[model samples]
Target chain A: MVPSPVMLKPALDAIGKAIDQRFDKLLAVPDDSRARLYEAMRHAVIGGGKRMRPLLVVAACDLFHVERDRALRVALAIECIHCYSLIHDDLPCMDDDDMRRGKPTVHKAFDEATAVLAGDCLHDIAFEILADPATHEDPFARLELVTELAVQSGPAGMAGGQMMDLVAGDVTYDLAGITRLQQLKTGALIQWCLEAGAIMGRASEGQRKALRAYARDLGLAFQIADDLLDVEGTSAKTGKAVQKDAAAGKATFVSLLGLERARAQANALIDQAIGHLSGHGPEADLLRAIARFAVERDN
Target chain B: MVPSPVMLKPALDAIGKAIDQRFDKLLAVPDDSRARLYEAMRHAVIGGGKRMRPLLVVAACDLFHVERDRALRVALAIECIHCYSLIHDDLPCMDDDDMRRGKPTVHKAFDEATAVLAGDCLHDIAFEILADPATHEDPFARLELVTELAVQSGPAGMAGGQMMDLVAGDVTYDLAGITRLQQLKTGALIQWCLEAGAIMGRASEGQRKALRAYARDLGLAFQIADDLLDVEGTSAKTGKAVQKDAAAGKATFVSLLGLERARAQANALIDQAIGHLSGHGPEADLLRAIARFAVERDN
Candidate 1:
């Protein structure tokens, strides 16, 4: 049975609060000049976004009954990577975004230099959190988390995807090229979130494979939803510029596939994503709900 | 007797070659649009700088007789951190420098967006290398390396120091303030190098304490030398802009202590740095030579 997307709301709100509190505790402002750096980081990370990635992590961990605190730690690490990337991407050199999450972007709020350093500090903190003994009882698990996050976010992953996006205006990409780009840019970290859960829980090989398959389809569906939002979402709702890919002449899922076809494709991907979890029962309801939310979310 | 600083040259050259080769192998360009990003990273990392940090890591590991391969992996990781820091620092919003290590800065060689992503990619690569099992037979050791590097390079360390440096024009830093800033900025990573070696070797606490003391003094002396160079060296000799600190009215060791007093203090610190290594014989000679070279080198 398909779960109601409304059920995903409670989990999303709970994860959002947990993540905000964790960042607040971790980024206490120092009474020094460096306070500005911390503030910039806090400003960028403390209150923003859909918390989608962290939610994905927590939901995956639920499948294995991983400790909430342990899962939260991994969630925070991935969120930091996400926040840092957003901060850098919004810089005048990249996206030139002024607003994020309905507030001034880091560079817009605290100058370009501070934004750069803040993004960098957040990047360092992600690894520091993953490497902490508190994150996992076994050192091997902690190491695995660190390695997966690093590989998924570095070149050939998120950063590599961003590079492709940066040159998208000049290089004409067909559907295959766009799919590859999204897989690296947005899909890689999303994939890491599920793998992290499996690592922490020490899930069996078959279980891990099931989660991997779920993540892959969910990631693609998530990107398709994002492309759809870019075309249809209001700036007020999105909290940042919309229609940017189209304006830049960059080929996106929506740009290549007409509006009706793109909506159909997103729904199809979500259905496929949900199908990947056929082996699990009611325990996987949150994951199923999230897959629906990926396509249904307005922002 | 103090070894001649000249003895440090052979080790420096060898580590430089090894690091360059490793980066070359690690960053083979993709046959896609992301090739620009890889080129920017290779440009920033390959065939550049004195590689002081990597050399320190290798030398410290030598004290414990850790496998040369293991030490090199750790060294490459640290070097990546250092290189990424340089690339970011040279950004237009940061130090705004054009040349680094006698070549165009990454942002100058590539576009600003590519430079930003390249620096981030290198930052990711650093943790990936440390978290790899090949870096250490023990997962605990790999986790320790990742933790130490992240802590030393994050908010309370390198990035924090950079924030203070950025605000130096507005903040009136006295001797203590300047010292604290430098300690966090430069001293932290140098301290990490020594600790990494100790961790890999599983050194006695007393030995770790000694290296800590040595690193503290050497890092300060290195900064003092840098300040001295800023005041007295030519841009051509330094491969970067010179005397910008004085022009900006920022207080550095040389500016606060006067040239003669600063030079004398550096020499004294070097003497103290070498004194911390007195417990060991010729195996410690390279470290001793490095301590002397820290204050004596032109760049």
Candidate 2:
């Protein structure tokens, strides 16, 4: 049932192409006074990364037999939301981050005002893209995707998780607290990626539930690996500061449980993620590869 | 046609009560760890403002003989969006104001980070409320409301207009540019209020267009009067810093057209808004009253 990595690559490439086109279109803001806001948004989003979030979305859609083009805009919208979070997280008042993807953060590149507005606009645009009637097939399904996206990204979700991280600080929070933080902060959006794909493709209830399980596990594994990477990575390689979590006295899975246990937790999640896709055929195989890819990733 | 203000008061109060109840239900974060975020959001939204936006929503629904309860959650959601915008606009990075509704701004009441996340949470909650299946007559109509709300509040809408204002500082901009800014910044949401109400009430195409025209003109007129108020009203009475717009070198209707001409423009738009309600029965009377109220209000 393994979707050949070869097949996934072309699909992934197609998604990249679609996302890039939308990014370009968004950047083409009218040359009016508001152009600066669009410019900041473009700078934030167009600065490419692994594009993993969008890939998950498209892959999820693929699982349910959703047309690639049908899921394209939603995929791009997910990436936009992710990029906006990154931009805002890097803001001086937030994480005080200066570098993102080996380049200056939006606030550093533009002014803080533009960066704030850019983040706002990016989040707004994510919903706008999903809600675009010209792109969606079933408007109800599109609304479902948007609802999922908002729940994942907003308060009681990612933003809430961020607040937890900020408050937890150097406090020796419990494992439950750490998991809650990771789930809300990271798992939510990842869950949406899978859910959006399933919804777009009109997957059966069972498939949708299975994909949710897969995404939840995949997200946790991904975050743990991220924590591990921070401890074991180089700034030159990761394009972000290393050991900064400890320096900032921030709570992380690695800091809370040490490298060995964190690795075990992540591997366990990956196993669970793969296990959820047992009956899904080739889609399951591709998802398994993704699960492996997420935790085994060095950066 | 003018709605009896006395009769409208009870309806407006009902809208307010529904909004409070809906928001209270939605913002009940089960996780205690996010206590601060919940607290900040409560402070930002609960017991805030005249609920003018929600009133417009309820009034629009009333005109179509739809129960105000039908649009109650949406009314709350729209007001949340409006409140979030105000919070962000008052931030030092944006308008740098210290007070709103005679109280400290969100950034002042809570930390800027908390304020930012609170606004973020509220914005997301708006869409969440709209997408709730329990709130709508049918999925398609509900999704339509979602799309309308998204576009009206998004980058091409309110946020875009705010971006324009940020970039408009110190620029001797013309009337058209200023009008476009106001339309997007404020008018979009106003238009959405009417359109969403009509859709929820299952109004005919003609009725929808008529209400849309009424709302748009009222929105423009409201903005123009606001500019004039900023120029001539007392800071204590307006609950806003008088002459702040002029001090910031921001482009405004009054600044572009001069005080006398700005007043004239507002009156003209109010008249036009009234015209849109022509041929409608007593149900349309409230719409006219709101239009007149927009330009003639003291504060």
Candidate 3:
């Protein structure tokens, strides 16, 4: 059963605080010229966003009773990828975003060069954290994490997705084209979050398959919801510009399917996602709530 | 003793072809919208600059008789990092150079957004290559390679060094400051190339130490030679802008020490680097030759 927002709030709050504290510790500014790079990274990452990705990681890990600390480290690595993408996407050359998460973007705050390095540095740190023995006692597991993260976030994944988005205005994308784009851009990483937990927990193949199925549907639901937010969300509520896809004439789910169908599709996907977790019991409630929250979130 | 230029030439050519061929295969363009991103990556990486870092990885691996295929994979990974840095560094928001390796920079050939994504994609691919089982049969060795590469190329290493370089014009750096800056920026990855070989070969502690010492001196000498090239060589020879440091009024080894002193210092470092390999016999010739080549090459 899907839990209410009130029930899900605690998990989200905990993950947010955990991620913030970890980043604060990880990005302690050095007393050197590189301080600006660190500060720019911190500014872009700290005290921002809904922490949805980390929340998914933590909730997935909880399913197999994985250690919280281990889960948090993996969560941080994934968040680093997510945060780096946001910083790069917000660059003037990309989306030219001025504000992100209700504050001046990294380039606006620390110049273009620093923003670029900050994003690059974050990308490096993601692998560094995963490869460290502290992240996982098993080298095989660490290698798996590194390999998966790289594949999902690299050319065949998120970057490729962004490439499609960049050319979206020039190219007319049908539903299938947009679906492929979103799967690579957003679905890949979200899917990795679930797979990462399974990897860490050493889940059975059947369990892994179920999680993959759940992740696939949930990722689409998440993107459809994001498209909806772009159409209907407020900058104040979303903490960034809204209606950008429409303004740019990009083909998104909402743009293609119309608002009513898009909203219904998102809800249907969330239900399908929750249905994939039928084998799990109370432990999977957080996942169900998160799937619900995917469409419900304003940002 | 250092081998002759003719002796090194064959090895250089082999590595260059190998790296180019590997990149060509790895980046086979997708039959989709993402083709531009892959094309930009190929444009930046294939048939490009001196494969110095890859040579080092192969040479060091030669010391312990690591498989040629394994050594080449590590070499490719290091080259990816090097190429990605060049692409990002040439961005308009960064160093803003139009040329790299005598060709239009990635950002010049492709648009700015594609360049950024290409660089990022290459960065991700580097770790992906290292973590793959094909790179190493042993997970421990693969993890070690990933950890070292990440640490050396991340915030405290290459990226940090680049950050200092971005602020070089603003800061009046003394000789010591420039040394530290160069160590992080160029030295880190160069050092990683050697260490990667050691990890892959499972070299003993003593062997690793000797290689580290050799790498340290060689990396500095290489940077010093680069500074000398910038001051003395033309864009036609170096395949990049010449006298950029001087034009920007940024302090470099050549700018601080003048031509004669800088050239003398580079020779001395190369000698020191070669001395570190004294314990090895002719198996070390390629490394010794690389040291000599570091200070002697015009570009």
Candidate 4:
């Protein structure tokens, strides 16, 4: 889709390395009770992912010619929030899904109780990692990271969007309502990723605003592609059951706008995401590639 | 009981005003989708309990002659964490209780999904409130508040203790096990209250340590009294179903040691709490009154 596999693979590799290293250090809180919590946190966090958020961090830094190591902890911290949300969202009391990443969901793999605690602990540890001076050099930057992470993950964003998903069945859904839901549910953390990287790299306000615009557009495109995949792809390709979105009566973009129009929206968003990176030079090539990848991926 | 109504009521009143004012300001985030979550959080946080944590803040601030207003935001923050834990603990997937404070648990009052979100939102908001510069004048004080709040509420502290409680169930728990459980579950927040207050007041390390000792002892005494009340008090006084601990087969202080031995432990803890406050003056008097009140309060 983007003809930029060369750029994507290396950023993905760096994201993997950064996630593993920072995860090990953050899990070392010195109390047995807390240690147990961290063990569960480790299980959920490192379990598996496309590592998209961390990749955003590394790619954004690389785009700015900033060192990847400088953004490592922030990368892992954002992923921790992502992993934690997945764990909680998959609980029997929530989405009630049994499969995630082709494996049993956290509540099924670990005990539901442990899954709950693991998610809670990871959420806190993310902020703790961001706030720690050893990881984040600038106090103001640290504050901004913490503030952004909290806002994105908290009521006004991811969690609130989830509540809406729970209450608003697909039966009465519209395109605007579905987009609004996806914006908070899926877009907040994606925006956090780009913003966090830019902040850590000390990007100018305009550059940061551009990065955010790129992320927001890319995030919506990514979610629409996911909904399409759930509808059109097989279980083997996506690692999740195909067509379960419709079965669950979810308020997805495809469900609201039909497959054709939904696909069109994703392509438009991808174009916008790439458009925002026009003046940033070759460093932003990977980000542009990612925006294309978001809408074009098979799974 | 040390027989001092003179100090207790005033601390409670001040704490009420602090929590109400701070909570009002904190929940004003500009997102309508989150408005429902904010409403649920407001429902859980406001008009609740004796404001134990906030009282600790006021008492500790008074010890150093720091203005109670300085610790107001921190007081509200810690209370938010306390409220969140309670809301989650009452979820049907967790403790499954239907009643708290003479009314329905969050899950019962709202939906289970809303309760889960209410807890998640409150947890994030706690740190959000604490990190705001409006909470404290000194930047270092703000950092200290964040650290203390995270330590007390995160894995090593309240959440871990909660996990322990979940796993322990009714398994012939011993005195040491019960004490450790209470220390983590309840004592952690109380400890934060004292430590955060002293730190905000810029008290020396020694002063912070002493206040911590007082809180630790007070918390245990409070828990034991709560156990005794569950066994003897009516639902009207306790604001919960009578004999819930025994019915749930919970391993409480009263159940482990019998009423008489539990009373002895409560008295010992009260004495220790007072001893820890010995060097501090009128402020210590307020703490001593709290110690006496904890072991003897009807509600």
* TM-score against native, each model: 0.99, 0.94, 0.99, 0.93
- By the lDDT metric, which is better: model 2 or model 3? 3
Per-residue C-alpha lDDT of model 3 across residues A101-203, encoded as one tens digit per residue = 9999999998999999999999999999999988889999999999999999999999999999998978899999999999999999999999999998998
**DockQ in order:** 0.94, 0.64, 0.92, 0.52
User: In model 2, which runs have C-alpha deviations exceeding 4 angstroms?
Assistant: A1-14, A133-136, B1-11, B29-31
Which segments of model 3 are wrong by more than 4 Å? none
Please, what are the lDDT tens digits per residue for candidate 3 over residues B33-61? Answer: 99999999999999989999999999999
- Candidate 3 chain B, poorest ten consecutive residues by summed lDDT: B1-10
> Candidate 3 chain A: minimum summed lDDT over ten consecutive residues — where?
A1-10
lDDT (10s digit) by residue, model 2, range A19-95: 87879976797767787887788777774676788888777777767777767777888898898889878877788
Which tens-of-lDDT digit does each residue in B1-299 have in candidate 2?
36544555565577677777777876775656788888888777777566778888877887767755667877888988898888878888788888888778888988887778888888888888788776686877777787787777877899888887877764556888888888999999999999988887898999899889988899999999999999999978877788888987777898788999989989999889888888687777766766777787767
- Clashing residue pairs in candidate 2 (N, C-alpha, C atoms within 3 angstroms): none
Best by lDDT: 3
Where does model 4 exceed 4 Å of error? Answer: A1-3, A28-39, A64-67, A170-173, B1-3, B28-33, B65-67, B170-172, B248-250
Candidate 3 residue B164 C-alpha distance from true site, Å: 0.7
How far does residue A6 in candidate 2 sit from its true spot (Å)?
A: 9.2
Q: How much is A15 displaced in model 3, in angstroms?
A: 1.1
Q: Tens digits of per-residue lDDT for model 4 on A1-299?
A: 44464567777776777687678776764554445566677777764677888888878876666655667777888888899898888887787878777877777766777778778877777777778886556777777777788888888789878876876752355777777778889999999989987888888989999999998899999999999998888877776668876887767888877899999999999888888987787777788878877877776
Interface RMSD (Å), every candidate = 0.5, 1.4, 0.6, 2.2
Query: What is candidate 2's CA lDDT for residue A19?
Result: 81
